[model samples]
Every structure is written in structure tokens, then in C-alpha cells.
Target chain A: MTQKTLRKGNEALAEGAIRAGARFFAGYPITPQNEVPEYMAAHMADNGGAFVQAESEVAAINMVYGAAATGTRSMTSSSSPGISLKQEGITYLASADLPCLIVNVMRGGPGLGSISGAQGDYFQATRGGGNGDYHIIVLAPNSVEELGNFPKLGFDLAEKYRMPCMILADGILGQMMESMAFNFDPVDPNKIGKFDWAVDIHKNGRKKSKVFSYKGDNLIADVTERAKRYGLIEKTEARYEARNCEGADVILVAYGLSSRACLEAVSKAEEKGLKVGLFRPITLWPFPSKALKEVSQKAKGILVVEQSLGQLVQDVKLAVGDSVPVGLNAYPAGGQPDGEQILTAAKSLLTGKKEGLFDLQTHAEGFTYECKRDLSLGVQGDRKEVK
Target chain B: MSTILAKKPSTLTDLPMHYCPGCGHGIVHRLLAETFEELNIADRVIGVAPVGCAVFADDYFTCDTVQGAHGRGPAIATGVKRSKPGAIVFSYQGDGDLASIGMAEIVHAAVRSENITVIFINNAIYGMTGGQMAPTTLVGQVATTAPKGRDPKMQGWPINMCEMLSQITGSKYLARVAVDTPQNVLKAKACIKKAFENQVNNVGFSMVEVISQCPTNWHASVEQALEFVRTKMIPQYPLGVFKDEGAK
Candidate 1:
């Protein structure tokens, strides 16, 4: 029997990385994902691993790049804003074809919007946030159990393809506690096989291998090869989950925390004798476009639900095309869409009543930053208040 | 039979270097190659090259090497050293790569006392970008951006990395040297060897800053460049050990 333990999502992911043979972790602190580096700092040494609280997100990602080039399993984690700072290094990692695990336990963003959960990074993760024509394998986990299991899967996929892989979660999933089973055997870094392309000592009389990003005259050829590899990954690794799509009037599309809300809305719609189903994308990058298209063809309409304004709805439109009308219901950043709201939107779409898209710009009246009036006052005010 | 006075170090490959005539990078590369041969660490050493004129350094070094983004070599070196503690790792960077864009990385690596060696080449100008100003460009020195000699009031004073890094408690060794003269080249080699030795002994973070010359960027002859290093650069960045906790 597998051992079961209740753990926070962030802690389980860190432990999962260790069990996957990740021996190097470097990260900077950020909300929703701080527990990852904090847990690694406390336990990594005990597992014969090294952990570093890097000076900045830029340095942390570069550190992971170095370790990964040496054939060591390495990882880094951050929230949305911190992950933005890591884009340069991520692009370099992709260009060099280095394997590593990157986790973005997303928070509200567009510039440090809030410390709460948000799925606003759907486009940033699925489409390339980093420059260049490259794609990272992106995995989305709706539950804590999947969060614990996905890091190992991510590492395996990254190494197998010689590419970086990302685990995209949100503050809700990262902070929530749930009972999860640790079924797989822990990996030993020492027992791992050698990489022919790694930058280790050439004791076997082989030529020293240079792990550099510069392609020189082979730039076109190199990128073409990467694109071919991406095609293979898309064909082999696209994953998704579907519920109650048989004879449904409408299908709801969501992922991560939003998927959980969709499940509840599906049950409520079913209780009212409305034919509604759910389509949750497990891999956001190699997006389950085929699965979504197949299910959307059977439904009368599709409702895309999310925490952010309307990021995932764009992808839904691309996948299903004009076969059926795709509607969107978006809660504000830092707020989750409840079952009632999703049900109402689904019912409205099914009845041919199109609800307007949620506009974050108009709704952000109270959330804007303002300079404190007291700080603008000169020394006439109390010195303590001046600050 | 005549005794051979000198031969090329085995640590250096046959690839022709990309540095301009009289550039200090060539001399520094030679010293590094000689040190690696003398210490018998060439086979196990892994070098991190910066995104500057020396970006092609992997072609010149016989050992395994990785090219890092501009100003990120130290962080990369820290990762390589930590992952494979047995492998000798070093990062080679230039003025703009280290003092300007990479300042935070080097400072934090020193604070963490990462067991790695850093070879910092301070030429006082951005060589690859064709004579642009650098953070280490001496006051009153003219660069492409500072066509009128740099004014401390406008461009800020040149940074002395050896002095600043010495203040960090985790730095086990810090030294500033130049390769303009033959004697100074020997001293620079010795300083580099000691920095690498500190990492091998697991002492702590170590670095050697080499005050170098860039004739092409300076728009000066090779002789004038050497003279400029002695007269102008030395006054601002004195050649000596700034800190050596390992010695104590």
C-alpha cells in the first residue's frame, strides 16, 4: 500500500521534485509559491541536494540552467511577476535545449496585481511569453494530488525531449491542503545515466562537449529541428479530461482552479435537467484542441470560464472555430467564479441570450494604486508620517 | 640539440582567437591556460563564457564550456559548481558583463560564498559593442557613448569591484592585478591560480580582477593602451589583494 499524507500543494511539489532526482533548486521568494523554496531550504540538504535562495529571479533561473547543463535535475519556482523576470533565461534555456522544471504558482498580475489566485497567465504559459519561436511543455493541475505527481512527470518529459517543462498552478491550488499518496519510488541522482552532451570531465578520451546556445551557421537547421521535436511532443503528449459530454446542450471549458468550479456548475446544471458537460485541459501548451473540438461539435454552445478577464476564451475560439458559438464568463483577478455565476452564464448561452464579456478595465476602479496624501506633505507634518 | 624555451599550453585549442590586436583578453586567456596546465585541472575544469567579445571562448578552451547570457556567468557558475562539486568551475567575464549588468549576481554569489572561481577582465570599456562606455570606464576616459571624456558628475564614477566585493564577509579571496607588463602577467597568473585553489580547497568564493587593455575600443595604439593601463586605470583600481580570508 502507498503511504498517504496531507500536504500543501507547494510542499508536495517540492517533495515530488526531490523524489524525481532533482538535486539542485534555486529560487527567490514570491507569494503563492514561497512555500516551495522554503520547504526546499529546510529539507534539500537532508536528501543530498543543494538549495539556494537566489538574489533575484533572473539569477535563480540562470543557476538552474547551469545545473541542468551538467546533467543534474534542477528546478525553480515563482509567481507570475517573478516568472516574468525569468523570461530571458528561459529563452536561453530553450535555445540551448537544456532540460529543467519551472513552476509558476500564479498570482494576479499585469504588475503585481494581488497575492491571490488567478489564471491570467494562461496565454503567457501556453503561448510563448519568452521571445523566439519555441514552446515549453506546460502542465496544469487542478488538485493537490496532481500537483504532487506532475513535477516528476514534468522532469521526465523535459529530459526525454531535451526541453524545459512548466507546471502551471495558481495560489488556490498552491496553498490548499489535501491528502495525497506518494506511490512512486524516489530517484537517486547518482544512479542516473550519463548524458552524452553534458559538460562534465572527458575522462573516457571523448572530445569535450560544449553546451552553448550559439548556433552560428546552423541557426535555421537548429530551429527547424526544434520545431520537428515540438510536433512530436504535441502529437504524443496532449492530455485532457472530459465529463458528461453525451447529449449536452452546452459544454463548459476551464482549467486549474476554474475547472473545479466548472465541475460544480456542471452538477448544478444537470440537477436542473440542463444538458451541460465539462472539458478540462490537463496540458495547456500541447493544448487538447482535438478533444475540445470533438466535444464542442456535440454541444449546442460552449462557455469558457476563468478567473482572469478572458485569456483562455481566445484559445477556445482557436480550437473549436465557428462550429458553435463560444461564450465567456470571467471573474475579476484575485476572485474565483462561483458555481452559480457559471451556471447562469451556461443557461444564458444555451437559451441564445449572449451576455457581454467582463471588462476588467472598467471594474478596476478601487484596485488602482494611489500616492498617500500625507506622504506628499512636507516637514510640517509629523516626520514619521512623512515616510 | 636546443632546449625549447616555451610551447603552447595543452589546455588551449588551436582555434584562432577573435580578439583585436593587443587586446588584453589574449594574454589573460594564455595565463588561464598556463594555470590550468600547471594545476593539472584542465581535464576536470568547466568554464562559463560571457556574452561579450570573449563569447567565443568555448572554441579556444579545450575543456567543456557553457555560454551564458550577458551578466549571468556567476549565477551559472554557482549552479555548475553546486551540482557537481568535484568539477572545477570558473566564470570569465568582462567589465560590462560583470560590474554593470552583473553587479547583483556577483555580489550575491560572494554573500553566499559559492565555491567557484571568477575571472573578471576589467578593460574599462565595452569591447564587443565597439568602444561603448562601461561601468568600469575611468573618469576622463572617452568612450563612444562618452565622446567627451566621462565626467564623474554626469556618468558617475567608475566602479572598483575588488574594493566593493572585499566588503562582503563570504568572499574568501579577492585580488586585483594587471597583465600590461611581463612581471604583472606573472602576478596575474599567480592570483588566478590562488582563486582556483580556494575553490578546490572548498574555502569559499574567490575572484581575480585583471585590469586589461583594449586598443581597438580605446582608439589608441598598443603601446598607448599599455601606457593608459599603467597611468590612468591603476590610480583608480590599485593592483593588490583587497581581501583574503583564506590566508587567515
Candidate 2:
């Protein structure tokens, strides 16, 4: 039976890796996610497993790449600045299609911005951080429970797709304690079969093999095939969670801790007689655009709430097209958006008013005072038409 | 017969070696392959080769082998050892790969007490990439990068690997040996065997730094390389067991 225990996101990640049959961990410590390496060191020490506190993040990532090449389950964890140092190895792993798990407990940063919880790395995690026409399956967990469960899923997806999978979380989710289930099914490595290319000992009559990332065939054909594979993955694996989306007039799109806050706001807005909902994406790379489009059909607007400057909002806008208005509830670096504030914005949109919502692209679009007055007059004339 | 010239044992198949004639790497490779044969651990041994002179080591050693990027052998070996706890994993690294680029990898792997063996070959220069001076090159040693002889004021001192590695508690066995003479080759073989045995017994990190000769890079004859090893390398990196608690 699955049992629950008090655990933080980092501990859950450690347990999940163990459950997924990860036998090796090589990482250097970084704040907010140091517990992962520490736990692996202690646990692997007693089990005759391997754990190495590499001298730097660069060394740790290359180590993971090497281990993964041998068809073994291995992992590493770090925060923003440290993760940046690992881009070189990550690109190589992606090019090789090596299977491994990487956990990033994000803190504020363009460059050492802050140690506090921040969702500032959404683009880097989703897009190309390293140099390559490749993508990693990025899983963003919204709760302590998901933090525990996603590592196993990440490992399975890594092996299944032959690609790296990331558990993109923030410092708060990593450090906060909550009760969670710890039991997991045992992994049978043969289920995935021994990688024929793995550099393992061969007995008599076995032919030598190679495991490299070089794509040396017809250049265009090789890149074209890789692109086709990525397209297939995009079609099949993109996943997200939605709540109260049925017949809702307004949707809130967010990820990680911000999604949790958006869920609370959506519930409060519902109590105050506004049709509100939430869309929390699980896989950020194979983004849940289809699901967002389906939700947008019934919604009048989408409020993209996030801890960063609403990076995902652009994605939502792209998904929904111009069929519905896409709003923003941005909470810049230091402050967090309150549920009351979100509720008020929902009320304004429900009543056909659009005066005080945050418009991240307003000045960039060159909206002057004259434009606002003209828009307000138009809205008044539309009200007269309704009367 | 010494382990150095023991007829290429079953552990190391006679698959025409790809190394150049008079290359000391061949001697070091034979010593390790024969050690695996002597210990009867060939079936369960895994070798990690770096991107240097020993890149094709798998063609020589009969055991399972994987290649790592430059300076990443130790980390890869640590991962292999961790995942396959019942198997023996060792990284065969050269002076440039181990002492220079991979310095951080080897150091931290030893510090963590990873239960893997490392056979570090210090030839005082980078042989594969055309004889650049290595971090282990002695103060007065000359190489392509150190044309004026390694200047102590400009370049750093020759790294004493055995002495430095002995500081790590994670290492159960650490030693520096050489292959200049018949007697010294024997001692070096014994040290390598012990390091491998330590891993078999799960005794933690083990390493043997072999002070080797590089005739091509050092601009000397095969006999002269041996002579240089004895007259120059040995005095700097003495042939002895620096640290060993393996039998305990």
C-alpha cells in the first residue's frame, strides 16, 4: 500500500530517483536544491551505490552524460546559476539522446538575481538553453505530491523517448514540507531492454559497438529525421491540468507555485459569481497548446498569472489566437499577486470593464492616452447597442 | 616472467595494438589488462577510456569498455560503479586528461570515496594532442607548450599526484609507481593489482599514478626514454606505495 509522510519537494525527488532505479548521482551543491545531492550521498553510501559531489556543475553534468551513455539510470540537481553552467553538457546529452534526469530548483535570476522563490527560468527550461536543434521534456510540478511522483515519470519518459527530462521547480516547492506517499513499484530494467549501443562488457562472439552523438549520415536527412521525431513527440506527449474549465468565461494560466495561487484565486472568483478556471501545464516543452485552445472556446478571456513577468502569457496568447482576450496578472520579482486582486480583475472582465489590468505589452505597442479614450468610447457605444 | 611481458593473457586478447611502437602507453595498458587476467575478474570488469592516447583501449582490453570525453573518465567510472555495484569499474587516464582538464573530476570522485579504481598515467606531457606540457611536467621538463623548459615562476610546480591524492580519506589505496626498469615495472604491477583488488572488495577509491616515459614528446630514443624515466621522473615521483590499506 502507498503510505504518506511529511516530505519536501527535494526529498520526494530523491525518493523518486531511487524508485526509478537511479543508481548513480553526480552533482555539486547549490542553494535551495543542495538536499538532493546530500540525500543521495547518504543513501547511496549505505547501499553500495555511487554518489559523487563533483568539484563543479560542469563536471557533474558531463558525468551524468557518461553514465547515461552506458544505459544506466543517473541524475543531477542544481539551481539557476549552476544549471546555466551545465548548458554545454546538456546540449551534448540532447544531441546524443542520452537518458537522464535533471532537477532545477529555481531561484530569481537573469544573473544571481536572488535566492527567493522565482519562476524566472520558464523560457530557458522550455526552449534551447544549450546549442542544438533539440528539446528536453520539461515537467513543471505544481505541488509537493507531483514533486514526489514526477521523477519516476521523468525517468520513464527519458528512457522511452531517449531524451533528457527536467523537473523544473522553484525554491519554495523544493524547500517546503508536506505529507506525501513514498511507495513505488520496482523497476525491471529488461522492460526497456539493454541498450545495444551501451558500453558494457561483451562476452565471446559479441560484436563491438559505438555510442556517440555524431549524426554523420546525409546531413539534411539526419536533421530532417530528428525534426520529425520531435514533431511526433510534440503531438503525443504534451500534458497539462485544467480545473473548472467547463463553460467558464475566464481562464487563469500558470505553472509551479503560481498555479497553486491561481487555483485559490479561481475558487474565490467562483464564490463571487464569476466563471473562472485554471490551466496548469505539466510538460512545458511539448506544451499543452491543444488543451488551451479547447478551453479558450468557452472562455471569454485568459488571465496569465505568474511569479515572473508573465512569460507564459505570450504562449497562451499564441495558443488562443485573437479569438479571446488574453490578460496578465504579473507579479514581478519581489511581490506576489493576492487572490483578492485576481478576484477584482475577474469581476471587471465579467462586467465588461477593462480599466486596471496589467498590460505587459502596452507601452511597447505604443498605446497613447488618445487610444485609451477612443477604446473607452467604443466600449460605451457597445454598451448602448446592448441596451 | 614479469607481468610486463607476460604473454598477452586471455584477459587482453592479441588484437594487434593500435598504439605506436615505443609508446609507454602500451606497457601501461598491458600491465592493467594482465592484472585483470591475474585477478580472474575479467568477466565483471568495466573500463572507462578517455579521449587521449588510450582512446582505443577497448580494442586491447577484453573487458567491457566505454569512452568518456576529455577529463571526464573518473565521473563516468563513478556512475558505472554506482549502477553496477557488483562489477569492477576503472578509468584509464593520461597526464593531460587526468591531471589538467579532469583535475576536478578525479579530485571530487576520490573525495566522495567512490568505490572505483583509477590508473593515472603521468608521462609529463600531452602525447595525443602533439606533446603539450602537462600539469605533471617537472620544473625543467620541456614540451611543445613549454619550449623553454617548464618555468617554475611562470608555470606551476610539478603536481605530486600520489602525495596529493593521499590526502583524500575517500581513497583506500593511492600510490605512485614507474616502468623505467625491470624491478620498478614489477613494483608498478603490484601497485596496480592492489588498486584493482581494493575495488573488488568494496574498499572505496583506489588509484595508482604511473610515472611513465614519452619518447616521442621528450625527443629521446626508447632506451633513452627509459633512462630519462630513471634519472629524471623517478627522483621527482619516487617508485613506492604512497598509501595502501587494501588488505585490511
Candidate 3:
């Protein structure tokens, strides 16, 4: 492992993709994720690769579909609204079981959300944004180092399952700098397994292959098989990092940047004579629920701290069950709560003096910058305001 | 006496196509198949099927095929061609998939001058979606969306992709051909062959837009549909190569 001087999560992801043999990148320049395509534009030529700043997110993902069908390692990166445009193509990518990487440096949204950091796309990322009964392997990184390794793992899993894999990160992760070591196993194009169903011209007496999503008549049956695959993934791919849970009274569950804040909050609470622990999910989709279920038994309560309005909190309640009380420090839209607020919440929870049960709260004043882009509601259905 | 329909062209299979009766798509498919065969690059050709009438084109083409999102055939084809430099890539698209939803894809693909082929079938109206108005719908054409007849003020002027694409320097072989008659079918085949040859030689973006008859959408007899392509559609969408390899 060669230690590189400090690199941002976006840069680390780019370097990791290159080391893992990503040769094709298609994306429109969106905030936070601009570095990914920028890096590819400069370096792709030298590596005999391709980089295209597509006209729209829709075009970019279709380009990914094309490249992946040819059995090449390809990727695309964007922020929230842009990722929304890509859901259609991503869904098709999932249906085709094409292996590619999609990096989403999430920002605020139900629509054209801000460009600033927010974990609002948590449900979209982990649940497979596209309309399908399928799921992408969603990996969330709490640190820059994990960002570097997670992409390699994403590609490996994508190839392993013959599906698209997403590195679900946030704007903060994309921008923050940290010292990280770059480690990757070289992928030989020859060693990579070719799906005979992929669309590649056969040259050496090989059978012809076709790649398509028209699994007609039996669409439901096909979707059911995809769900079963997700079941297996849920059973074995749960990943999380536990700290100070030996005899904890409260387990603070968080992911991405919020998880980092929760970690600090745990330490701060320990200093205040409160027994709290941190449960950070690295794989947000195959959500380390089993581990959380086991940990929930020993704890008095579980506080779900996330940057979204009670999204992952529901998952926590489902896993931990009604045996323990669950509290939510929910932040809606672009409001990213900080360590100070989280520490206060942790302290209150330990002392049985916590404020409100599942309070639907917005981010406390003045911790984040609003994105300049229009944060219009982009949901397909009618928007009802959450009070 | 045994009569064969030209051995099903080397690039296409003998399996009966799923196209409606008298649909010009089958003719265009045959022409493309023959073109690939003539170039002796059938095995090295990869085709992208679009979401409209020709969505099941993969089943027709003996070559490797991939289905793209509606109108995304060109972008997908670009990916295949660029990835496998030695291979020939083409997208078979209908009016809805090519002129409307996928407009950005084909236009951008041409602007980028990707070394690929795009076979655009224009029949004036959207045939697969219950005769809806397409971007290529004529000035007075009537479709489900344009019940009052396509008004230039309400519905924009029909998009002539050949003329539009010809302006892009990236396009090397751009042509608007018709497949309404046997004579036109032969001409269309030649045009498609040249486009494929351009890709084999790494000559930039090439396209063959075939003015086809949509009997079902036009609500005309099979013979009348052919007449419409020859009389009305051709006068508006004239047959000729708009851009040649020399320009690129």
C-alpha cells in the first residue's frame, strides 16, 4: 500500500477507479462530483480510456449502459438532481445486470436540491432509485480512505452479482481532504468474466450474445428472482463498524458524514459519564441490520441520527423491534446537524431526559451552505408538506 | 419452383419478424442486414434496438444486439463502437425513439463524431404509441396528440435530422434515403453499406435516415402508405447524402 499525501474523497475515488481499471466515464458536471469527471478527462487519454460530459444525466447513464454492455469497466458521477435524471437508465442497468460503478455525492432534495452536503438521497441510493424490484449494492464511506477502498469493492461486487454498484457518498465526503493509502488489485480484461448475454461482437467462433431489458410476460417473475438475490445479499453482505458497545446503554446509529459526528458525540458523551456507542453502517443497502438487531438487545434505547427526515430511523426500529425505545434526531432537506447538537442529544438520551420522541426536526440554524441551484420538488407524485 | 427472399441477408436471421403487416421497418431491417453482409463485417457488427416499433430488432439481427432506453440507441451504439474499435455499431430507431425522446442522444452522438452508424426510420407519426404526433410529424399531419392537424404555431416544424446533422462537422456520412419502393430499397441499402464501411475504416459518425411508410399510423392502405412516402414524405424529406466522408 502506497500512502499518498492528503486527497479528497472524490480524488481518492478517481484514483481507486483508475487502479481498478475503470476506462469509461460519462457525466454532466455537477457540484461536488465535478472532480471525478475532471480527473477522468485529463487522465483517460493516457490510459486509452473514454470520457464524455454528456448533455444530460439521462444521456450519461445510457452511455454507461452502452459501455457496460460491451463488457468494459465504466462509471459516472453526479450530485442529487443529476442522479435523479439517471434513475431511468440505472434501473435498466440493474435489469440488464450490467456491472458498472455510479458515484453519487448526495446533496439536498426531493427535487433540484442544493449543491451543499446532505444525506437526503439515502433512501434513493440504498433502495435502488429506479422503479424496479431490484437493488444496487450501495456502499457508504464515512472517511476518505473508505471512499478509496469502497469503489474497488463496488466493482468487485458488481461483477460478482452482475449488477450496477453505487458508492453512495455526500458532498462533504467528496470535498473533504484526508491522508489516504491507495490499494487495488489489477483487473485483467481477459480474466474478467464475459456475460454471453452482453452485446459484444463475437470474433473467434464464439456464440453471439444479446443484452436487453425486455423480459416480457414474465416481468413479475423476473423481478421476483431479483428480489431473491437481494434477500441473499441482505443475509450475507451486512457491514458495519461497532465501537464501545461492550456494555452500552444507547447505540447511536448513523451513516456517511453524520456517522462521523455521531462518533465524536459518543466520545463527548463518554467524557460526560454517559455510556453510549456508535453503529456505523458501511454498506447502507445490505444494511447491517442483523448486527443492529443483536446490539439492540443489550442497549436501553437506540437513537437514529441521520441527515434525512426519519428515513433510516424506520429501518432501525424494524431491526431493533419494540423491545427498545428508538429516538430520532431527524434532519430534513439540507439541514446537516453537527457534532455539538448530536453530543447534546446523546447526553440527554443517556440521562433519560431526551427531548421529544421522533421529533420531525429541520437542521438547526447556520451549520451548512444552501446550494445555488433550484431546490424545487422533483418527486414524481404530488408533494405534501411534512409538518 | 423454389423462390428464396435473398437468403435472409447474411446479417439477419430467417426467423419471421414481429413487425405489423406492410410495416416499412422490415424492409429497412433487411436493407441494413444486407449492407452488413456486403461489407463482410456481419460478425463484427453490434446493433442497438430502440424502444419503439423496432424494439425487438435484436431478434432480427444475427449480430450481437443491445436494447437501449427509448431514443437512447445512438448513445448506446457510440459506447459499443468506441469500446470495440474494430467493431461496427449501429442503432435502429423509429420516429418516437429517434426524433422525440432520444433527440439529444442522436444529435450529441453526431456532434461528437462518434465512429458509429445510426439507422433512423422516419414515418412521420409515432406508430407504436397509438399514432401520436412525433417530432417528424408534417405540417398538416393528424395524430392522436395533434388532433387538430399539426399546426406550425402550436406544434413546431418537423425536424429534418439529416439537414440538422449535416451541419455538424463530426458527421462523416449522413444521408436521407427512402424504402418505399424496390428502387428506393436498393438505394437505401447502398447508403447503409457505405455508412458501415465508414465505421470499418474509422471514418467518424455516419447515419442513414430511411423515409418509411407507417400504414397503421397513417391509417392508409399498404399501397397508399408507399405512395405517401414517395409523394408527400419524400418531397419534404428528399433522398440524398447530406454529408459525405470528405467533409469529415
Report the number of clashing residue pairs per model: 0, 1, 1
lDDT for each residue of candidate 2 in B35-65, tens digit (9 for 90 to 100) = 8888988777888877787887866877777
The number of the candidate with the highest TM-score is 1
Instruction: Give the alpha-carbon lDDT of every model.
Output: 0.88, 0.79, 0.82
The worst-scoring run of ten residues by lDDT in candidate 1 chain B lies at B239-248
lDDT of 3: 0.82
The TM-score each candidate achieves on chain A is 0.90, 0.89, 0.89
Task: Quote the true-contact fraction of every model.
Answer: 0.80, 0.44, 0.69
Model 3: CA > 4 A from native? A350-387, B1-5, B246-248
Interface RMSD, every prediction, one decimal place? 0.8, 2.8, 1.0
Local lDDT at A313 for model 2: 77
Cα-based TM-score, every candidate:
0.94, 0.81, 0.93
| C-alpha positional error of residue A260 in candidate 1 after TM-score superposition, expressed in Å | 0.4
Error of 1 at B26 (Å): 1.2
Write candidate 2's Cα lDDT for A37-140 as tens digits. Answer: 98898796555456877888988888787778778887899999999988877876787678899999998887888887878788888885887688888999
Error of 3 at B157 (Å): 2.0
